[model samples]
Target: MSILLVEDEAPKRKNIRSLLEQMDLLGLVSEACSVGSAIRSLRSSSFDLILLDMSLPTFDIVAGESGGRAQGFGGVEVLRYMDRFKLPTAVIVVTAYPAFSQGDKEIDLTELGKNLEAQHPKIFRGIVFYNSMFSTWRDELKTKIEEVIIR
Candidate 1:
């Protein structure tokens, strides 16, 4: 299966790619460092899965400015675009807000997930947090991927 990985941080993206490779599921994997890049990649090719990050320091190619990180929903816009165009790719949101580093000011993303599902059902397969600082994150991600693949 093909996969599109959307993330901003270089090291994080590298780590995820390594994990995907180790899992033996890295078939035709593509990377996008920003929202604009992700959009461009999607427009050019079709993917079976999209691994997304919520907060991104995206650069808008058209606007020549920042895209969604300030408003704190970069992945939301990408999802909306996919819905608008009826892209038939499955999405899995992986984030690290309010859980690992947010301290006391962490925002609950479940509501956002619910809203997305309400607006566009069946596109989002799962939502997983980036608790990868610890040891179990790899296993969790693997499980989620396996679950999605089976579906």
Candidate 2:
């Protein structure tokens, strides 16, 4: 299956790509490092699944520059874009953050997951909490990917 991985951090993105390669599920994998790049990719190609990072920069950072504003709900914005265009791609949010601020209110990952599933049921598959120090996230991600593959 074709997959789009949207992650701003190079290390995390490399880890995810390595995991997918190890799992032998790296079919037509594409990478996007920011909200703008992700959206541009979405507009240009069709993906069977999207592994998204919740927090992301508004645009990609150049090699020698780093002044772009970050968006706490960048993945959510991608989902909104999918919903708006009625894209049928399944999404699995992979984030390192435990909580995020929505306007003035801070919501935990659980609430955010529930809200995302409820609001974008058509494309939202699940959320996986990722920590480089832990292996549980890898297992959870494997399970989620298998579930999506089965469906």
The TM-score leader among the candidates is 2
How far residue 56's Cα lies from its native spot in candidate 1, in Å, is 1.5
Which structure among the candidates has the greatest lDDT?
2
How many clashes show up per model? 1, 0
Question: Would you give me the overall lDDT of model 1?
Answer: 0.77
Every candidate's lDDT: 0.77, 0.92
**Per-residue lDDT of 1-151 in model 2, one digit per residue for the tens?**
9999999998999889989998897767999988889999999999999999999998899878672888888888899999999999999999999898878899998999999989999999999999999899999999999899999
Taking all chains together, each candidate's TM-score versus the true structure is 0.82, 0.95
**Structure candidate 2, residue pairs in collision:** none
Reference-based lDDT, residue 100, model 2: 88
Alpha carbon deviation, residue 140, candidate 2 (Å): 0.3
lDDT of 1 by residue, 1-151 (tens): 8999998876777777878999887766888867778888889999988998877666632356555454257787789889888998999887767432244555566766676678768698767767657756577778888887898
